[model samples]
Target: MNILIVFNHPYEGSFCNSLLNSVQNGLKMASHSIDLIHLDKEEFNPVMSAQDLKAFRDRKPVDSQVISYQQRLEKADHLIFIFPIWWELMPALMKGFIDRVIFPGLAYDYANKSNTRMKPLLKRIKGVTVITTMNTPGFIYRWFFGNAIQRALIRGTFWKLGYKNRKWISYNRVKMVNQSKREEWLVKLEKQFSKF
Candidate 1:
């Protein structure tokens, strides 16, 4: 499988980076081709400019960066997103990537003239996985906030684009976990991704 990993942590030595490494190693073990997009390292612009909104409304391309990202998305059979959950949401960089790359006429389109529903365009993508770390407990994040990331990415984005096999792996209380526990999580991630 051609797997595209979109990573969005700012710090290089962070646990999210470790998680990204583990995911890459596992996918490599399975002999899957990997394409990585390190958003912070790439210095991606997260803000939507007036020109971007205009292009979107006009059904035109946003920019070269977004076009390149979309081309990567088009070639990948599986997609993975690794990031830290901040304030119960994705980082601004990752959100902006979604807004800009997953544009209309690319990710989805109107079913008919009635526009009753959307038809997904990226049907070649077989699976989508999200790995997130947070300081809050998993139960609270799920029950209280209703797993906002899952809803946004899986339902709002991938599912709307006709993807059904979506998985979410969240490491809660990351700041409180010990190094040994973090290693164990990495091993678990390796095992989980080997099956993919």
Candidate 2:
């Protein structure tokens, strides 16, 4: 299987960073091809300019880098998103990355006259996992945000894009966690990756 791991955390020593490494190592150990993209280190712009939108709609052209990312999504069998949950939502850069790169023609197509239905372009992908960390408890996130980013990515996007077998693992209350708990989470993540 080919896995594309998208890491959104900017900090080098964050727990998200560790989780990214764990997932990568586990997947590689499982004999899966890995394409890990650190969003903060990438040179691609995250802006969706009006001209770029026009070009996308016209099916003319777009930034080659964005096009390449789209192609990776098209080819990968699994897509993993790693980030820290802030304000009960995804970071601005991560959201912008999605807005700019996963454009209409690339990720979806609205061919029907009513525009009520969309054709998913990433049907080749079969699985998705969102790895997130938050300072608040998991229950709080489920109560306040109702797992906002999870639903948005897993249901609003990937499932709609024909990705079957969606899963999410969130490490919560990291600020109050002890070393033991942290290691436990790491072991759990290692096991999760092993299953892939």
Candidate 3:
């Protein structure tokens, strides 16, 4: 399987980087080829300009990098997103990648005559998995904050785009977790994805 991992984090010392490594190691154990898109390292432009918006309306990608990302996605069988939730949402770069690359006529299209429904065009994709780390407690985030990350990424994005097989693994209160606990989580992640 070709797993496309879209990772968003500027700090190399962050735990998210460790999570990325853990997931990659698991995928390697499973003999799945990995394609990583480090958004910050690539210096991806998050803000959509006027021209970009115009191109978006036309269902066309104007940015060279976005086009390349689309090509990479086209070859992927499974998609993985690794990021840290900030302000109850993903970083702007990952959001922008979705806004630019996962556009109409490429990743999806209107399925009905009324244009009220969408059909996913990424038929090669079997599923999507999102891994996130956050400072807020999981219970609070889910009950109080309404799991905004899942709402935006899983339900709001992929499900609405007609990709039904979606999963999310969120590590909440990451800063409070002890080193041993974090290592355990990493081990579990590696074991889990090794079968993926």
Candidate 4:
């Protein structure tokens, strides 16, 4: 299986980075080809500019970087996103990637030129898996904050685009956890993806 991993974190020593490593190792063990998009290393521009907005309005991407991402998306049979939750939501880079690359004519389009209807263009993708790490407790983020990440990533994006088989794995209160606990989570994550 061809997999595209979109990852981002400012610190190399962060738990999110370690989780990314575990995921890659497991995928390698399964003999799946991997293409990684490390947003921080690439210095991805998160702000959408006027030209970008124009291209978006035209239903075509003119930005070179977004175009490159679209090319990678075309080859991915499965999509995996690994990032940390900041401010109770996905970081700016991940959100920008979606705003720029996963636009109309790339991820979806108007169905029969209807304003309210959409047709997904990513037929090659079978499923989406998101792995997120955060300091906030799970219950608070879910019950109190209303799970903004899932609502945005799943319901607002992929699910609405007509893609099914969505899965989300979140590690909450990671900073407060002990080293042993973190290591156990990594081991479990690796074993899970080894069968993917």
Candidate 5:
């Protein structure tokens, strides 16, 4: 299987980075091909400029970078997103990557000129896993906020695009966890990715 990891975090020493490493190691152990999109290191432009919007509306290509990212998406059988949740949502970099790369003619198509519905274009994507870290307690994020990231990415986006096998694993209270607990989380993540 080809797995593409979209990692969004600024600090290299952060827990999110560790999780990214664990995922890569696990996938490697399983002998799956791996690719990474490190948003910060890549200096991805989070802003969708006027020209980008115009080109999207015109059904024309945006730019080489976005095109390259879309091509990666096309080749991947599975996608894993690693990021820290802020304000109960994805970071701007990941969100912008979605907005820019998963544009019309790539991720979906209007059912017809009437545009009453959409048909998914990403037929190659078979599975999606989102791994997130949050400072908020798990109960609060799950019950109070209703897992906003899951709803946004899994239900709103991927489900709408016709992908059904989706999973969300979140590590909450990350700042309060001890080293042992963090290590345990990494072990668990490795096991999970091995199965993927």
Candidate 6:
């Protein structure tokens, strides 16, 4: 399997970065090819320019970066997103990456709009996994936002884009994570990626 790992953590020394390392090693041991993209290191502009937006919606050509990432997305068989939750949602950079990379014609087509049937562009991808952590508790998140990050990453986007067998592995209240719990989560993630 060709796996594309998208990382959004700003710090190279963070827990999310450590998680990425574990995921990469696990996937490699499972004989899967890995392509890692650290968003902060890349020159990705979150702001969609006026002319670019107009051209994109008008069926005209946009920047080459968008086209390039779209190609990566098309070729990926398994997609892994690594990020941390801020205010119960994805970071602005990751959200903006989705907006720019998952374009209209590339990710889906609006021409076939109807009441029922919707088109899916990423149907080729077999699995989508999200590895995220947060400072808040799971109970607090459930009571307030009801798994907003999971819904947005797994259901709202990937599922709609046709990535099957979606999975979410999140550790909440990271500020209180003990060494034992962290080790346990690392082992759990390794197991998950082995099956991927």
* Candidate 1 residue lDDT tens string, 1-196: 9999999999999999999989988888888999999999999998889999997877676689988988888898989999999999999999999988887787778888896678777777888899999999999998999989988987888777777788888999999989899999999998777776
> In model 6, how large is the Cα lDDT of residue 8?
94
Which 10-residue window of candidate 2 scores lowest in summed lDDT? 59-68
What's model 1's TM-score? 0.95
Error of 3 at 23 (Å): 0.5
Model 4 segments more than 4 A misplaced: none
lDDT tens readout by residue for model 6, 1-196: 8898889988988889879988988898899998887888986777778877886687554877767777788888888999999988999889988877777667766435562433667656778888898999998897888889767878888767666688888888887989888888888888777776
User: Model 6, poorest ten-residue lDDT window?
Assistant: 110-119
Ranking by TM-score: 3, 4, 5, 1, 2, 6
lDDT of 4 by residue, 29-147 (tens): 99999999999999999889999999999987887888999999999999999999999999999999988889888888888755687778989999999999999999999999999
Tens digit per residue, CA lDDT, model 5, 110-164: 8879976777787888888999999999999989999798789988888777777
The alpha-carbon deviation from the true structure for residue 44 of candidate 1, after best TM-score superposition, in angstroms, is: 0.9
lDDT of candidate 2 at residue 186, scale 0 to 100: 87
Q: How well does each candidate superpose onto the true structure, as a TM-score?
A: 0.95, 0.91, 0.98, 0.97, 0.95, 0.90
* TM-score of predicted structure 4: 0.97
Model 4: worst 10 consecutive residues (lDDT sum): 110-119
C-alpha displacement of 116 in model 2, angstroms? 1.4
- Which has the better lDDT: candidate 2, or candidate 3? 3
lDDT of each: 0.89, 0.80, 0.93, 0.92, 0.90, 0.81
lDDT of 1: 0.89
How well does candidate 3 match the true structure, expressed as C-alpha RMSD?
0.8
